[model samples]
Target chain A: MTTGVRRRMGVEERREQLIAVALELFSHRSPDEVSIDEIAGAAGISRPLVYHYFPGKRSLYEAALRKAAEDLAERFEEPREGPLGARLLRVMGRFFDFVDQHGPGFSALMRGGPAVGSSTTNALIDSVRQAAYEQILAHLGITAPSARLQLVVRSWVSLAESTALLWLDGRRVPRAELELQLVHDFAALAAVSAAYDEEMASVLRRILADEPSDGPFTDLVTRLVGLAPLPGSV
Target chain B: MTTGVRRRMGVEERREQLIAVALELFSHRSPDEVSIDEIAGAAGISRPLVYHYFPGKRSLYEAALRKAAEDLAERFEEPREGPLGARLLRVMGRFFDFVDQHGPGFSALMRGGPAVGSSTTNALIDSVRQAAYEQILAHLGITAPSARLQLVVRSWVSLAESTALLWLDGRRVPRAELELQLVHDFAALAAVSAAYDEEMASVLRRILADEPSDGPFTDLVTRLVGLAPLPGSV
Candidate 1:
């Protein structure tokens, strides 16, 4: 292992290796609790060499965060095929997969850990959220989102975030149900918005038109019907 | 005012005065931006006199935050009457009213400003959220909340928080609509959970039984029906 550490490696390879090591370490414990020395030891490199690749623990944490953010953002990207509800459920599965895999790091990034209030850290998290929002818009096939539509999308994004954070505290709720519930949550948010705004109503209409009879949205409707029949409906 | 400041006062009175002054200053701007001298000036007292009452700015901020937290927790208190929807709408109104009045302070409190990640601050905010959850459960007239019921209530609390934070960024939507929308968001969140768990379904049934035809929950059901009529109905 020592010989392997001494083996020739390109600069980019060395940086990526260090980031991977840091990410693995940060995954279990908070970035604050993890030390640069521990990272160096895990990477089988000297402390000086670790600093050679990254300036400090804060920088390394940000790099790892950026990587996690990118990976998490990609999770939100599902193929455009299939019903909207199914696509969202698939996206949520991958989203929670990332959250489960990168529990502490995800919490730190979302809850503002070492770089609390840091603009760069904020921008990275915002980018991931933006990616999710844009992906939803693309799925909706809406070129321009109305104010209410934007609100609905942003609110769902926040809901998913808070839900994941709370779930991370204890794995009490089953992950699978939470994933489908999130898909339903997205529809629930949009449905409420649709009731208030004509633009949102049209958006919801287009979404429902594409959904199948057994999708998560339909499941939500089925559950709602069990509570009470819609008044004035035959 | 300056002469009044020079007059003798009880120590507790002076301390309370300082906290109030700091809170007023922090309400407009982030606590980090506010200064001890400014707090003193606002209270018509010298900087040293301000120090005489409080140890430092951080302590003063915490004191002010405690006050804000108490006030915010109180906002969730609504007499259980009429219907849950109207009661929740009233709670949301008061919640947003506090948000509107204490924009920066509210942001700081929720987003972890000045004392970012401080346990005291975190506990204070958590206490407020806990208060909200308990108040909601009390309104539902439930002593033992199921896991799904807990999830629904907690998720609604988080939704309300993010909604207020976003609304504070830009007063885009009408306040009245946002308030009602938050109520709808709560019902929507609960509705989704109620669909999943039988425990939640019964909770929903009891809630619906008391709600009037024109209540927000009924409004949500009406809106949902507009999207797509439930299949095999009638």
Candidate 2:
């Protein structure tokens, strides 16, 4: 190792550097598999310095978890100024990027199994989803979403999470194709919800009308129409 | 204890009895929580008798897992002599019943994490899904499904598993309503697939036409219309 002079950094900068190192380690392996020594070693610092920023491994892990969650939530806060379908596509692209950036950690957070995950990590993960739900409602221009709409959005998120987790577990097609398929599934589920409730129906109708003809939403609905039975046939 | 009646049974009967007893215990607790003595006691037999059927806890767990899979697969094999929607509803009803009957064990099996589950359990779980896929294909009268069809069905199964798992974990509405919602989701996914693939679209169109007006398929399609934007609106 080059024994160059270590640059003095601010407290926040040091903490950020530690968290970044921890995130990289945890991304490829479970938190249990990562050691504080390894993290410090990778960052060219001492274990005591690591504990100064984090009380222990759990805190360090949670810090990394939050950073990842914050990163994901911030990404989802994309510009909502475009066609609704285009906006959703951008949001989906962020979701894909999160998976690409974090790799196994993304799957671990999404899995939420008790062995390698803590309640704190799970809550952080939930907040990320909650952020997505709020962003979706904000995009839809609904300040206070109806209860049914809330459930619909939340269920879709869970579905998306499971699908992505399974894909990351090696049941993957091309990432682009799967992400597009996810966008279609989201639209399809919204349509299903609108079918059973008038509130949802109007909400979905308004959402669809906000999309352009060339957007993915149009492609999704148009395709569904052909699979639909001939008019009056049923 | 009154040791008056130990029935003379065949080897298969005795093994089945032991597995049934073990399954009852496993339904509420993971395999590690269920002791060999408890399983033998539950079966009204001695510890050595349990060992006679299975060498250890892992083997007993495997046997119970196989029994549950068999029971579920058999249930999905309902008579294929009805309206396609009716047949699908019956199959879905069986899926719901399996969850209800097996309870927590169903969730654990579907979760398939490394803690309590192994490669064997995971494979058994996949076999359960495989059986459903075959049953669905048989119901559709398609002897040889295309590659795309296989992916579509597998993905739908994964979605259904996630939905059921979330419901069982207590994010549930009324049991009947959620099951109906699941049926709708399945139809919607098929419609999504049909949009891009001509074979799937034709298959879905035919299936939709076979449903009665009062069925969930009709309700689902009808609801979708209200949510669908007018063709020229986009």
Q: Which one is best on lDDT?
A: 1
All candidates' TM-scores? 0.94, 0.75
Tens digits of per-residue lDDT, candidate 2, B128-226, equal 888988888888778877644666676667666766766676644555666677678878877876755678777887788888877788778766765
Across A1-234, the per-residue lDDT of candidate 2 in tens digits comes to 776687778999999999999999989986767899999999898999889889999898888888988998887787769777777777888788888778887766554444345457657877988898888888877887655566667777766676666567664356676677777878888787665567777777777877888788778877666556534642
Model 2: CA > 4 A from native:
A1-4, A7-19, A25-66, A79-83, A104-127, A137-151, A165-174, B1-18, B28-63, B79-83, B104-123, B137-150, B169-172, B206-219
Compared to the true structure, candidate 2 yields what TM-score? 0.75
Q: Write out fnat for all predictions, comma-separated.
A: 0.48, 0.34
> Could you tell me which residue pairs clash in candidate 1?
none
Q: Tens digit of lDDT per residue, candidate 1, span A76-110?
A: 88888878999998899999998999897778667
lDDT of each: 0.84, 0.75
The number of residue pairs in model 2 that clash at the backbone is 1
lDDT of 1 by residue, B131-230 (tens): 9999999998888987778888998899988888888877788888989998888877888888778888787788788888888888888888768656
* Model 1 ranges with Cα > 4 A deviation: A1-5, A113-117, A232-234, B1-5, B113-117
